[model samples]
Structures are given as structure tokens and as C-alpha cells.
Target: MAQKNIVVIGAGFAGVYATKKLARKLKHNNDVTITLIDKHSYFTYMTELHEIAANRVAEDAIQYDLHRLFGRRKNVNLVTDTVTTIDRDQHLVKTKHGAYPYDYVILGIGSEPNDFGTPGVKEHGFTLGSWESAIQLKQHITDVVRRGAVEHDPKKRQALLSIVVVGSGFTGTETIGELRDWRDQLAKENKLDPEEIKFSLMEMAPTIMNMLDRSDAAKAEKYMQKRGIAVMKNTGVVGVHEDHVDLKDGSTFPTATLIWTAGVKASDQAAQFGLTQGRGGRIAVNAQMQSQDDDQIYVVGDVSYFAGNSDRGEPQIVQGAEASAQTALSNIIKQINGQAADVAYKASYSGFMVSLGSRYGVANLMGIFHLSGFFAMLMKHLVNMLYFVQIFSGYYLFQYVMHEFFRTQNDRNLMRGHLSRQGNVLWAVPSRIFLGAMWLVDCAYKVSGKESWFVDKLRLPFSWLQPAATSGASAAGADTTSAATGAAASGAADTATTAAKSVFSLSYQYGKDPMMVFDQMPHWMYSITKVLIPNQQVAFFMQKSMTIIEILIGLALVAGLFTWVSGGVSVMFTLIFCLSGMFYWVNIWMIPMAIAVMNGSGRAFGLDKWVVPYLQKVFGKWWYGQPQSLYGQDTVK
Candidate 1:
């Protein structure tokens, strides 16, 4: 078999993921090589550009290192170059330094901001297409706010503070939504009143968010209006200048920042190739995503115009780009395998969710169900997380979680500042140590009871070991010995602690010794108990083993050695005890403490600060054959 080269042009949502999918499926095929070429070292998460532009997240939050992504894949090759031209006849792609011939080509050259020949927009307006542009706009916003705070003239400050976003698409609406959060936050930072900084969204159509359901769009508009964002519908932007925007109604508004998110046209590379160009400079493609003039060349993403089965035949968002990529790649793979490229592409989009901000959103799922507020926002984040999981696995998903939840600024995240708690691991040290001390006390009591754990005839009262009938009889026998039945409500009666009434209106109490709170043990637990301790000798051995485990867990936690392991064991013990009816209301405090201690609590004043790294070095050598550890430092082989 002859070697086949698959060249993908861009590393955006479409090209990168298609290449990744190819690399995985054809990993063992020696006759194929998947080469991913891009101009940058990192892949910019384009959907998250609005978050960075509005200062909700840092610039690096939306960047995924391409080298880190494909480091372990042997069959995939990474190229850092700007593609100058594609020779369709020769099946060759030409870059500045070299030319690479491909058997099959995937064209994913992305879109650029469409100024629509509007005067001065290309020179004066900012567009959120590239990572650089987003960062530049973010800094520009900050500079405008800073100057507005100290300006002596009121009109100049007002002009400087006004920010108008012309377009009501996802990009425009989402950008304004994030800016809604930044409005008050940046105001305080600049020592200016938030009300003075104006935000306006202009749309030429009768309604905003034309991509979404009308009701959802209306709800989004209402949310913007409530937050002081001027939603300008049926408004046409005729011209954009250095300091003002001229509307179609013969009116001009002064503004320093004019963000243009109106429309996107295909990149110049599309037209330069001299293919069958369609509207918006897009190359026309068939249902199989193959170019009209060439069957070997497949075009995906925003640059490919497939004007069938879809409303407009052009996809602007990430979902459409990804779906087109899938369709294109599926046919490419089929053709490679000598099968008919018969996978027809059609548009069946699930739904759209627009976040008004980090805290609130409106969602229309499957065009049937509608949701708003926190749940909608949460659903929107879950969709992003799910997408990250699909394109890239745990690493990208984890990074998104960290950026959106823990590292997010201004309490503007999915968790709403709850998971943003930082610098508190040191404070958990006291709680971790205290919890370990209590476990040691319990172990001490178990060592020297009337019938000690390992001594003659172990007398450990496992509440779930016996049947319900036997347990009830034992409780009945002990009641005759209780002389006092009427103690105060707060006091224990008959040596049994009275619990709060159950939700089912069932009265239950924590038993002293002979009985437990749950009347019947679960079937699984009963079956396991029968096998685990069938005889006195087995029960005694099991009790001794349990005591040994407890002592080790307590000592390790107290010393802060392997706290993740010790804390996990403690949590397991806590869960088991609660399920077995051995834990009372007083013992419930261990659950949170167990969880907290596992989260780097031992790093502060604990042995795991030093121990985990050495263990990581050993584990690294054992697993990946490297002296340098995966999670820790380098050590001897």
C-alpha cells in the first residue's frame, strides 16, 4: 500500500478535531499520515472569545497548547506555517518555506469579520475573530474606562465610556452579556459610577438573536434591558468612525469602542484559490462537503457553503462547524477505505442557549422546552463541557472547568464564586489534624474494651450483621433493665438517643447497643455479611483487621502522610458506617472533613508535602519509563 498524506489547513474547531479523529481511528495504519498545519502554536477556543473580551476570564484561559495535545500521538504531525496557496491540480499545499503534496485535502481556512464595505469600519472597529483581537479589545476597554474616570469634561468622558456592539448574533449578544458583569466591576476599579458607562447593542433586524427561538430571544432582550443594556432593534449601522457610529436613520452616536460582530465572510484564501465561489466569498460544496469543482478537496466549517437541507446553507457557530467537519471527515475516511463516499450531510441542530452573563441564561432545547435563569446558564456550561469532551478529552475539559469555575474572576462563573475559593487549603490543616485526632481516640477505645477486638470472642457490635427480628428481640430484652423511661427531651432515654422524626413520619431512634436505627439491612449488605463473618473465628479476624486499618488511617492522617489516600479511606469508612446504621447524627461531621482533607490539606504542615513527590517519582518510573515524574520532580531510576 502506498503512503497517503492527509493535510488539514487550519487548527480551529473544525480542522483540529477532524485531524484528531483521523489520528485515533487510523493510528495503526502505516500508510497514512495526518498532518495538522496552523500559523500558531496554540488552538484558540473561539466560542470563549467573548469571555476574554469582557474580562471575565484571562487571555490564556481560551488557549490549548497544540504540542501538549498531540505530544503522544506518533502518527500525527504538527506544522507551524501560514498556508499561502493550494494547488488543486497537483494536490499540493504550499507554505512560505515548503510545499507538501497531499492525497486528500481538508480545507478549514476560517472566516473573517465582514465589514460589508462600510466606510472606516475596517480601520476603526474591533472584531472578535482572533485571539490577538480579543486581547486588544479587552485592553482597549480597560483604557477607555481608565480615561473616563479621570476626565474633566463630562461629554468627552461619556463619549469615551460608550461601547456599542453592532450585531445581535450569538457573538454580539454574548459579548454584551459578559460586559454586563464587567460594567459594575470595571467601574469600581476605575473609581467611576457604573451607570455612566453605557452599553448598546444594535441590530438591523426587527428582533435580536435571530438564530434562536423568538420567545428565548425576547427573554434574552428582557434580561439585557433589566441589566441596563440598551437593546437597539431595527437599527442599522451605516458607518463606523474612529469615535462615533452613524446609524441608517441619519443619526450619529459618539463612542470610543465599536465592536463589529455583525457578520462573517470566508477568508481570502477561499477566493484566491479560484474555486466556485458562492455568496460571502464561501466556496460552494455538495452534500458530501466535497468542493464543487474537485472531489478530492473537502471544505468544512464556515468557509464551505452547503446551501441545501439547511435554512441559509451557512453555519456561523461552533456547532455547525463541528458537524460539517464530521460530515467531511466521514466521507474522506470512507473514500480512503475504497468505499463509496455516500454519507450525506443534513442540518439537525439540537438547540441554542445564550448566556446573558455567567450567572443567568436562556435556553431553548430541541425547539420545544424553554428554560431561563441559573438552570439555563448551568445547561449552557454543561454543553460547552460536553463539547470539550467530544473534541478533546479530559485535559481540555479539566482546563475549562478550572477556568470557568475556580480561576474565573469577579464571582462571574458557573459556580457563582462558590468554587472560586482559593488560599483556603492552609486553613483546612487544623480541621484535617483535628479529624485525625478523633479517629485515634476511637481506635484507642476499640483496643481495650471488655471484649477487645482481637481478644477472646470479639464483641464488636456491627449493627447490620444480624437480622431485623434478632436485633428487635435483643432491644426488647434490654428495655426491662432501664428503670427510668421519662428523661428530659434533650436527654437520652433508655440509653437510646432519640433522632428527629423521619421524613416519612416514621419514629426512629439511635440504639445504644442491641438495636440500630434502620430496622432492616439491605439485601446486598446482608449477603456480604453472611460471607464475611460466618463464624466466631472469622468475625474475630475481621474485627482485628478493621482495627489495624483504622490505626493506620488515623496515624497517616495525623502525620499528613498520603492524605488523599487516608482521607479517602476515612470517607469510605464514614459511608459504610452510615449505611450500616452504625453512625449517629453526631458522627455526620466526618463526611465534609474527609472531603476537605483530601484537597491538598496535607501540603501545609504534613508529610505528604514531601512524601507524595517521592512516590510520584517512583510511580512515574514504573509507568512511563522516565526519570522526570509526570506530576512531581525528577529522581533516580
Candidate 2:
């Protein structure tokens, strides 16, 4: 008796789990052999990538060994290689290294970042679409920060700190928010000035997080703004230079760090497989999670677009990828058993969660839940833990906890010696170089009052608002209106003009509002107040009370301690003690949380870990001491 062969492409969440389920279901029969083919041996847990870049969590924490993941499966064989082509007629698949015959094939190769014809983006910017990219970004960030520490010039330092994340979509917006926080922590840990750090998230679209409801998008914008992240809406990167990004609005943002997450497109590999692909090059898959034209082949994740009323009929997210894999797995098992089992892959994400560093985050579930402070931070940690537990089971859970506990101890040793050397441009000579040439060209334009060849090629438009000094009021007077009733007309015109300006200003303000932390404070307070106050609605009364209580208790504790120790309370000394204590435990924790819920726990993964270690390796004795020494030179005593 011969065995049936089933080959599944991609080792992502869908492919890996699908393989496991299929193998388990067909194990008893011993009549089916499941072959899992992927470009990588291991499946990447992509959700925690922001933490990796920030160095809050280690790479190995989220990434699982493929063999380890499927060690118990007797009927499954994992093949590590890229699948180059798929032949439907012959039921064969060609790989980069070899070829395999398949009774049924599953395509779940996943997705890649869309450059969208932006010049120099692929050559310059980094996108967080993959583990390798995350690692690269982490290394680059570490190098940039270290270099910033040693840089002599202020302008160059600012540029090194200037991190512009393109695309205000979920991945772009969330990733940039995390980067902002990581920079802040890195700055504090390294004794770098907060003023020197610059982070921006730009989008060409009218708004960000477009998939969310309008209100949520508005809230997200406000949150981004509160953290001082420059939200350049209705603006996009048109060109990427070595040190600057040319925007669609004819402006250039000088930055050394450019992270592109603006858009996503399907892999070119889909076309090679001869699957029917639509907009964004995503393969069109049918109800069984199989390719429409080829029943044996299945496509999952962002690489394949599946239609569904679930999730509001939008495109699939990370959750959808997992769902697709599960469905494909069941169908594969049914086909192997010659059972009439057909299931349509349906995915509806419960909600979305975005973590802003360790303490701050946002979750949109049943209703808009704006999480911050300890609870929100806790949620972020729990989410990370849940992801690991869900994917690899309890095996990595204990290790993750233990690794976090010992992380700070190891971090202390690593935080000392080395200065960051990442993405540090030594000179602004390029700016000056371009500026000088532009000035010369401007001079020529002034002298000749004519368009240059390059200008003509660019099809650049001239400024209609150019000052009257050049064209004079004679050129503008034609647009002026004459008034019949001077006083009344003036008043009416003024009123109308004022109203128009107000409307325009309001719209502009709304558009300019950046996504950041603390924007949800009012809403959160309002919700709490609705429950707390009986007679009148009070905003933030609880937080205010907590702060006051913390202060008073701190004072009482100080007084009591002094009475016990020396039998007398020194008023000035007692006040100082109380204030310092409040600042340390309550104020420090409360304010940042109230603004954004982030904690310095398992959330950090990449640059922070590498930079801290690299610093300790280089600085040795001069390195900053353990986490306790961060507040002051001495311990609590």
C-alpha cells in the first residue's frame, strides 16, 4: 500500500499548525504523509517584533525551533527550502533546491512590504515585515544610538535621532510608537537628553489605522500626538536619499532612520504558481482555503486574499493567517481519508492591540479600551505571554518568565561599556552640498527668470503665492472686490471670513493630531467618573485622590519613621523625604502610565539588549550600575 503525499508551503502560523493538525488526524491510518515546506525551518512570531527591535525581549524568546514544534508528529516531514513553482496538471511542486510530487498542495507563503514605486526606499529604509528585517533594524538602531552618544556636532546628533516611520497603518503606527518609547528608555538609561530624540510616523493617506472606526482613528491620532510623534498626514515619501526623505508636498525630512511600512503587496511567487491574483498581487483563494483555479493548492496569510463577511469583509490580518492554516489543515485530513469534508475559512479578529513600550498600549475589543499605566502594561505583557503559550505550549512559558527575571541582572552588566555606532552620518555636507547647488540654480532662475532643464523634467509648479515684491500688487488687484456698503459689507465679509477660517483651522487641527499616549485619559476618566461620582461627574478624581493619598501616606510614613528613630521630626527633612518618595514610586509611575501604558519588562527585545551588552563590553568598570543605580548613585539606604 502506497501513502498519500500532501505538501504545504510556508512555515508561518497557518502552515506550521496546519501541518500539525493534519499529521495528528491522519496518524492512526498511516496512509498519508504530510510534507511541510518553508523557506525557514522555524516559524517567526511576528507580533512581538517591535519588542525585538527595542531589545526588551530576546530573539529566541518569540522564535521557536521548527523541529521542536513538531517533534511529536510521526507522519509529518518538514522541508526547509523555497518553493519556486507549482505544477497543477502534474501535481508537482518545484523548489529552489529540488522538486516534490504532491497529491494535495497548500500555499501559505505569507507577505512582504510594498515599496509602492517610492524611489530609493528599498535601498535605504527598513520595514518590520519579517524577523530578518527586525534583526537588521535592531542592529541599525543600536549602532545609531551608540554613535549618537559619541557625536560632537549637534545637528548630526539630531539627524541620528530623527527616526521617520512611513505609513500610518496598524503596523507602521504601532511600530513607530514602540520605537519612540524605546528611544526614550534608551536615552534615560544612557544618560542622553530627551530633547535630542526625534521620532515621526508619516502617512500619505488622509488618516491612520484606516481599518478602525472613525472615532478610533481619531483617538489613535490624538494618542500619537501626545507623545510628540510628528504625524505627517496626507504626506508620503516620494524619494529616499542617503540622509533625507523627499515628501510628496515638496519638502524634505532630514533623517538617518527611515522605516517603510506604508503598504503591502503579494509575493511575486504567487504568479509563478499560476494562482489567480488580484489587487496588491494577492492570490484569490476559495472557501476551502484553496486556490480558486487549483483545488489542491491553498494560499494563506497576507499573500492570499480570501473573501469573507467576517472581520467586516476586510482583508486578513495576522489572525486570518492562523485561521486559514487551521481550515486548510482540516481539509487536507478529509481529502486524505476520502471524506467529504469541506470548510470555509472564516476569520474575525476579536480586536487589535498595540503596545507602546513597556507601560503603554491600546486594545480595541468589545468597546474601545484605552489601556495605559500598570494594567495596560500588564495586558501587553500578558499578550506576549499568551502568544508564546498559544504557539509553542507551556514549554517556552517558564523559560520566558525565568529569562525576564534574570534579564535585568544580565542587562546591568551589558549597559555599561559601549557607545552606540548605528547609522551615524558624520557630516551635513550633503545638505550643504544640495543647498549650495539649489541656491545656484535659484540664482540662475532669478537671473534668467526661466525654468531649468531639471525643473522642466520634474514638471514642478511655480508658487502662485510668491510675494508682491516680485510681481507687484498690480498683478494681484484684479482679484480684489469692491464694496458698495462699506461698513456693512466689511462686517459681513469679516464674519464670513472668520467662519471659514475657523472651519479650515478645525479641520487642519484634526488632521494634524498625532497618535500618541494620554489622549484616552479624558475618555477613561469620564467612564470612571460616570460610575464614581453620584451628584456630579468628576474627571480624574480617582487619580488625583491616589496621588494625594500617596503623598500623605509618604509624609505620615516619614514622620512615623523619624519619631521611631530620633524622637523628633525635622520639618524640612521630612518634607524632602516625602516629596522624593512620592516622585520615585507614585509620580514617576503614574504620569507616564496616565500618558501611555508601557513597562520595561518582557516587551523589550532587540537593540536595548544588544546595546546594553555592547556598552558593558566596551566600558567595563565605567558602565552604569544595575537598574537600582539608575535613580541615584547610592542605594535606598
Candidate 3:
């Protein structure tokens, strides 16, 4: 068989997704090689670009390293170069560095800001079309604010502080929302009142969020108005300048920062690719996502115009992009296997979610349920996570959580800084020690426990572990008093006597002393234990093993070594006990303590500080390929 070269262009949502799927599906096939080419090395989370533009998150928060993404795939090659043109006649993709031949090509070059021939937009307006553009917008705002702070002239200061966003779609609405929330904090830092800065959303349409239901749009508009943003409807920008924007209604807004998020069209570069172009300069693709003019070439994302067995063409949204990519990739894989390229894309849109800043949002779910405010924001985050899981690993998911909730500054994210208010892990040292001490105390009593545990104690068993010496003890339906007396009488049983009741028992009486025998245990819960512990020998072995594990867990916690391992064990044991009808009402704090400590709490004044790094450097990969930097840097290749 001849070698097959599958080339994926652009690293946007659809491009990266198609590349990842193709690589994974063809990983074992030595004859196929997947090349993912992009101008940028990292994939940007386009939905969250507003965060960067509004300075809500760090500039790099929305990026995923492309190298790390394909690290484990031997059949994949990542090319970081500008794709200048595609020679469809020769089946070649020409980049700045070189030209490569391809057996199959998936074109998902994404979109560019459509100035709609509006004069001065490209020259004077800021855009959120790409990561560079977002960073540029943020920097420009920072510079303008810095100048505005010191400017004494009232008109000049107002102009310098004014920010006008022209558009009311997802990008424009979200950009304004984030700016509205962040403006106050930014103004105070620059020694100006937030009111001195003006924020506006100019929409040429009668209302904003035209794609959303009218009611949902109204809800979003209400939220914007409440946030102190001026909503100007039936407004059109005729021209944008360095410090002012001229409107069609003979109105003008003097502003140094004019962000254009009104519209976008397919990348103009595609027009030169010699593909059959359609509406918006998007390549015309069939229902199978293959180019109408060329069956070997497929188009996806915003650059592909496909009606796809529907009345309207697929809207240029994230869902449409990914769905189209799936169809394109599927057809290519089929054709590669000598099968008909017949997989057709049927547009199935669930709904849309638009965040009104990080704290609030509105969503129309399943084309049925309409949600607004906090729940809507939560839904949006969940949807983002679910989508991320498809293309990335848990490594990115954890990063997403950290960026959106725990690491976000000034309560600018959905969690509103509740999770962000983290203190030194060293402060948890005392609590860690306390938890370890409780486990040790529990293990002490179990090691000297009667009958079963005595068999394994040093191979001869502790004398204190023996049953009480009372004559009537066996017939008295178990007397804990006699057991204690016998334990105290043995001088070596001091450790056992000190902890008469296990710390886990917490003195909760379930119609009797729960520690003695776990009386009134649930039948269903103990069914498995009963079968496994049928004989005295197995029971004794289990008892001894449990005792050793508990002791080891305790020591590890106290010394702060492998806390994730020990803490995980502690939680499992605690859950086992609780499930076994062991009432631990008073000592239930151990569960949460164990869970909390698992988050690298051992790094503080403990061996884990040294051990974890060594493990990550040497034996770092999770059986899957992600680096084992749980709470450290993502040093992915």
C-alpha cells in the first residue's frame, strides 16, 4: 500500500478537532501520516477570547499547546507556518517554508473580521478575530487608560476612556459584558471613577442577539443595561477613526478604543485556493463536507458553506464547525479504506449560550428551556468543559477550572473568587497532622483488637488483643466494660487502653458501643464482607492488613509523604467504614480532610515537596500521555 498524507490546515476548533480525530483513528496504521499545519503553535479557545480582550484572564489562559496535544501520536506532524496557497490541481499545500503533497486535505482556515466594506475599520478598529488581535486590543485599552488617568482636559480624558463595541452578536455582546464588569477595577487603579469611562454596544439590527429568541435577547439586553452599558439599537458605524466613530444616523462617538465584533466572513486567503467559493467567500461543500469542485478536498468550520440537507446553511458557530469537521474526516477515512465517501452531515443544533460577563449569562437549551443568570453561566462552563474533554485530556480540564475559577483575579469569573481565595498550604500542616493522629489512634486499638487481630500481631499476636478473661463475657452478649478492664490490666496494652473507642467511632452509640463489633450492620452492605470473610484465617488476614494499611496511611500523612496516595487511601477506608453502618458523625471531618490534602498539601513542609518533583521529572506520564504535574506546570512536549 502507498503512504497516505492527511493534511489538516488551521488550528482552530474544527482544524484541531479533525487532526486529533484523524491521528487517533489512524494511529496504528503505519501507512498514513497526519500533518496539522497552523500559523500559531497553540490552539486558542475562541469562545473565551473576550476574557483576554477584557483583561479578565491571563493572556495565555485560552491556549492549548499543540505539541503537547499530539505528543503521544507518532503518526502526526505539527507544522508552524503560514499557509500561502493550496494547489488543488497538484494536490499540494504550499506554506511559507515548503510545499507538501497530500492524499486528503481538510481545509478549516476559520474566519476573519468582515469590515463589511465599512470605511476605516481595518485601519482604526480593534478586533477579536485571533489571539494576537485580542492581545493587541487589551494592550491598546491599557495604554489608553494609562494616558486617560493623567490627562487634565475633560473632553480628551473622556475620549481616551470611552470604549465602543460595534456589534451585538455573541462576540460583541460578551466583549462588552466583560468590559463593563472590569471597567470599575481598571478605572480605580488608574485613579479615575468608573463613571468617567463610557461603555456602549452599537447594533445595526433592531435588537441584540438576533440569533437568540426574542425573550432571551431581551433578558441579555436587560442585563447589559443593568450593568451600566449603553445599548444603542438601529445604529450603524459608517467609519471608525483614531478617536471617534461616525454613525449612519449622523451621530458620532468620540473614543480611542473602538472594538469591531459585528461580523466575519471566510478567510480571504481561501479565495486564492482555487476552490469553488460561495456565500461570504466560503468554499461550497456538499452534505458530506467535500468540496463541490473537488471530491478529494474537504472544507469545515466557518470557511465551509453547506446547506447540509437543511433549509438554511449551517450557521458559523462552534457547533457547526465541529459537526462539519466530523463529517469531513469521516468521509476521508472511509475513502482511504476503499469505501464510498458517503457520510453526510445533518445539522443538529441543541441551543446556544452567551455569557454576560463571567458572572451571568443567558442560554436557550434544547430549543425548549430558557435559562438566565447564574444557572446560565454554569451551563456555559459545563458545555465548554464537555467540548474540551473531546479534544484534550484531564490536564486541560484542570487548567480550565484553575483559570476560570481558582486563578481568575478580582472575582471576575463565574465562581466570583470563592475558590480563588487560597491561602498558604503550610497553614494546613496542623490540620494534616491532626488527621494523621486520629488515624494512628484508630489503628492502635485495632492492632490490639480481640481474637481475629491477635493471630497476626508479630506472628504471636499481642496478649492485649486476647478476649476479656471474664468468666461470663461470652454469654453476656459482648460487654465492652470487661474488654477494657482486661486491656488495662495488661501493661503493654496502654496504647490500646488510651484509645478504648476508635477515633473513627467518635463515641456514636448505635443502640450499643459501635466500636466493639459494628452492631446492627446493614445486611446488604455486609453481604460481600461475609462471603470474603467466611473463615477465621481470611478474617484474621484482612484484619492484620487493614491495621498495617491504616498505620502506614497515618505515618505518611504525618510526615507529608505521598499525600495523594495516603489521603486517597484514608478516604476509601473512611467511606468503607461509613458504608458498613459505622456511625462516624463526630469524626466525619476526616473525609473532607483527606480529600483536601490530596491536592498536593504534602508539598508544604513535607517529603512530597521533594518527592513529587522527582517523580514528575523521571516517571511523570500518567498511563496515558499527560505529564504528571498535577499541581505544577504543564511541561508537555
Candidate 4:
């Protein structure tokens, strides 16, 4: 069998998914080689570029290493080089490094911002296209805010604080939404009046998010307006200068920043390929996503223009890119297997979700269901989690949740665009001291108790170890021990017997000893806990180790050493105690506090402020001992 070269160009949403699918589909075929080529060494979550630009997320949060993405795929070879041209006649792709021939090619190179020949827009307007661009924009925003803080002249200060976003589409809306929150925080931190910060989202169309239903668009606009973002409808930017944007209405708004999210067009390579170019310079493709001129070459993502079966053309969104990639990959596989390329692209538009800052969002589901407020925010998170699950491991999803959602203070500080030198000192010190004191007190209580506090308190939750007597005699014995009168004793005995039998019988049957623990917990919880720690010896070891762990957690928190690890461990222990029915109310409180401490709470006051750096120097950036700043300096201790 001759080895067939299958080359995937670009590492965007469509390209990455197509490569992964190809790798899975052809893993068993020894006669096929899959090569993924991208100019960048990492894949950026382009959808989250707004978060990056707003400084709401760490740059690392949106980037996943390309090598790590394909580390487990034996047949996939990643090439980090720019694609210069494609020779359809010779079945080869030319790169800056070299030329490579391929049996099948998939292009998902994505698109770049279209300036539309607007004067000064290309040179002055910042874009949210790539990681570098997003970072640069973030820096520019930070610089403007910093400059605004000291500028005495109101006019100059206003110009420094104002931002004009050209377009009210998803990217533009999200960008301005994040900026709204960021600007407010910046104003507060700089001691400037928040009213001075100006935000404008301009759209040439009558409404924002025109692709969405009118109701959803209206909801988004209302949310934006409520957040103080000026939604300038039926407005277009004729020109963008260094310090002002010239609107088509002959109005000039003084702004230091102009974000160009108006539109994107296919990469220049699309036009250079000599293929049939369609609208927006995108390569024209058939229903199967194959090039109009060459069946062997398939184009997907924003770079592909498909005049589909419907009146509307395919959208240049992630969903459309994924759908096109699937269709193209399927056709390529079919052709490889000596079958007809018949599969057509079928877009699955589940819904659209737009986040209005941190906690607010609006979403339209399947053009039928509409949601707003926390539910919409939750849906947006779930969608992002789904994407994370697809590209990375469950651990990555956990990290994403921890970094993006759980740690609010840290995220806010990040969004504010600067890490103060004394930032950690302000919050981490008090939190660490308090959390450490609580842990130490808990350890003392556990150790001072007579009898193995571990067995009496923690182990008592599992009825499987010590079965309770359900006999009526046991209940009668309890009544007699109470020393009641004859008639009262009889009545009390009956009541005690009924209650004892009810609780004991259930516990024995279901392995739940709620009598000594939290009686409020559901029966299923006991069943789960019992199944997880069924072994007596294992349970005993865990019970004994908890006290020691508590002591160590106290010491670590007090010393401000390995605060995140200790705090996470503390959270785990607290959860275990709650599940085992130890201290329900106390554990609940401890859980949240423990989470707070996990965000590098000890960095400012505890030894971690200096210890972390020293350890990083000694250990050379080992995952566990990195500097506290690695987790975000503004993170709670």
C-alpha cells in the first residue's frame, strides 16, 4: 500500500477539528500520513480574543500548544511554517521553508480584518485577530488608562479613556462588553470618575447582531446600553485617525483607541491560489466543500465561500467552520476509500450566546428558546466547557473553570490591566492568617478529643462498619435508661423503638448511619460514599490521615507556603467531611473559605511572597513551585 499524504493547512477551529477527526478515522490505516501545517506553534481560541483584549483572561488561557494537541496522535506531523502558495496542477503546497506535495489538501486558514479601504483604519485601528494583536491591544488600552490617570486636562483625559468599536457583531459586542467592565475598574483603581470613560459600539446596520433574531439582538443592545455602552445604530466609520474616528454622519469622536471588528475577508493566499474567488475574496467551494476548480483540494472555515441551498450564504462563524470542516473531511475520506464525495455541509446552529461582562449574558437557543441573566451566562460557560472538552482533557476544563469563573478577584484585577506590586499584600495576608488560624484550631480540637476522634466522628457515617440494633428490646432499653414513670416509660419506649428502628433499619439497608451524622442528607449520598470507601482499612487510613493533613494545611497556610496546594487540599478535606457527615454547617463554610485561600492567599503576608520566588529559582519552574504571580498576583490568598 502506497502512503498517501493528507495535509491540513491552518490550525484554526476547522483545521484543528478536521485534523483530529482525520487522525482518529485513519489511525489504523498504515498507508495514510496526516500532516497539519500552521504558522503558529500554538492554537489560539479565537472566539475568546475579546477576553484577551479586555485583559479579562490570561494570555495563556486562550492558547493551547500545538505539539501537546497532537502529542498522542502517531500519524499526525505538525509543520510550523507559513503557507505561501498552493499548486493545484502539481498537487503541492509552497511554504517559506520548503515545498511539499500532497494527495489531499484541506485549507482552514481562516480570515483577516477587512479595512474596506477606509483611510487610516489600517494603520491606526487595533484588531483582535491573533494572539499578538490581542496582547498589543490590551497593552494599548492599559497605556491609555495609565496616561488618563495623570492627564489634568479633561479633554485629553477623555480622549485617553474613550474607545470606539467599529461594528456591533459578536466580536465587537463582546469586546465592548468586556471593555465596559474593564474601563470601570480602571477608573475606580485610578481614582478617576467612571463617567469620563466613554464606550461606543457603531454598526452600519439598523440593529446589532443582525444574524440573530430581532428579539435577541434587541436584548443584547439593551444589555449593552444599560452597561453604558453607546450603541450607535445606522452609523459607519468613514475614517479612523490616531486620536479620533470620523463617522459617516460627519461626527468626530475623540478616542485614543479604535477597534476594527467591522469585518474579515479570506487570507491573501486565497486570491493568490488562482482559484475561483467569490464574495469577500473567499475561495468558492461546492456543497461538499471541494474547490470549484479542483476536487482534490477542499476549503473550510471563513476562507471558504459556499452559496448553499438556502438564500443565505454560509456564515463565517465557528459553527459554520466546524460544519464545513466535517463535510470536507468526510468527502476526502470517501475519495480516499474509492467512494464518491457526496456528503454535503450541514450547519448545526444550536444557538447564539453573548456575554455582557462577567455575570450577565443573553442567548438564543435553536431560534426557539431565549434565555437571559444567569441562565444565559451559565449556558455560555457550558458551551465554552463543551469546546474545552473537545480540544483538551478534563483537567484542562477544571483549570479553565478555576481560572475563568471561580476566582473573581483575580479575574477582575487581570481585566483592570495591571498587577500592583502590593496587590497580593492587601488581600492574601488577612485571608491566610484567618484561614490558617481556623485550620489550626480545627487540628487542635481533633487531637484533644478523647478516643479516636477520627473513628467516632468521621467513620460513624458508614453504617456498614458498625450495624445498629433494630430490635424492640434495644428501644425499650433506651426508655428504661431515661428513668420515666410506669405509663410514661411505656409510651416513651414505644416512641423510641419506632424512631430507633426507622433510622437503624434504613442505615443498615442503605449503609447510611445518619443518626450520628447529618440526618438531612439524602439516602443516595450515603450510598455513594459507602461505595467509594467500602473497605474498612482504607476508610480507617483516610480518617487517621485527615487530622495530620489538617495540621499540615494549617502550618502551610500560616507560613504562606504552597498556599494554593494547601488551600485546594483543604477544600478537598472539607468536602470529604461534608460527604461523610462530619460537620455539615462548619464544612460548608470552610469549603468556600478554602477556595478563597486556594487563589494564592498567602502570597502577600505569608512567606510565599518571597518563598515562591526562591523556590522557583531553586526548582527551575517546576509545575508546583512556580512564583505566585504565575497564578495571577491579584488572586486571593
lDDT of all predictions, in order shown?
0.79, 0.60, 0.81, 0.76
Ranking by TM-score: 3, 1, 4, 2
Looking at model 4, which ten-residue stretch has the lowest summed lDDT? 626-635
lDDT score for residue 302 of model 2: 71
Name the candidate, 3 or 4, with the larger lDDT value. Answer: 3
Question: What lDDT score is found at residue 457 in candidate 1?
Answer: 65
Pick by TM-score: 1 or 4, better one: 1
Q: Tell me the TM-score of each prediction against the true structure.
A: 0.84, 0.61, 0.84, 0.76
- Model 3 lDDT per residue over 1-637, tens place: 6899998998898998898888889888899998888877788999899999999888989988776677677888778777888887788989877888899999999988888999998899988988899999989998999899999998888899999999998999999999888898888889888888889999998878998999999999998898789999999999998889999989888999999999888998898788888878889989899989888889999999986554346788989899999999999889889999999997878899999898999999989999998999999999888877888556678888888887777888777777773546887788788888888887676665463355643331211223343211112222224676663354234335434644445556565433423323334544555566554566567778887888899999999999989989988998777655443456677888898887677889889999989887565354324422221121244
Model 4 stretches astray by more than 4 angstroms: 145-158, 189-191, 310-312, 407-515, 518-637
Clashing pairs for model 1 are none
Model 3 is weakest, by summed lDDT over 10 consecutive residues, at 470-479
Residue 537 in model 3: shift from native, Å? Answer: 3.1
> What is candidate 3's CA lDDT for residue 170?
90
From the highest lDDT down, the ranking of the candidates is 3, 1, 4, 2
Q: List residue ranges in candidate 3 displaced over 4 A.
A: 307-312, 441-519, 581-584, 596-600, 607-637
Angstrom error of the Cα, residue 471, model 2: value is 99
Model 1: per-residue Cα lDDT at residue 525: 61
Estimate, for each residue in 553-627, the C-alpha lDDT of model 1 and write its tens digit. 888888998898999999998876655546554456788889888888888899988989898778645543432
Query: Candidate 2's residue-wise lDDT over 1-637, tens digit each?
Result: 3678888888776676677667666778687777887777677877667767767667766676566666566787767777888877788888877778898887877777889888998888888878888989988887777777778887777777788889877678768777776765678765788757788888888877777666657766787788888888898789997678898889898888899987778767777877788668888877787787878787777777765553322364767777777778778777666786487776656666665544455566645565444455456556657655555445456655544433422131112212111212223223222322332343344222344332212211111222222111112111224454563464456445434533322122453422112111232333433345322113234334433443443342222221111112223323332332211222122222211211211113212335545654566334322222111111144
Q: Over all chains combined, what TM-score does candidate 3 have? A: 0.84
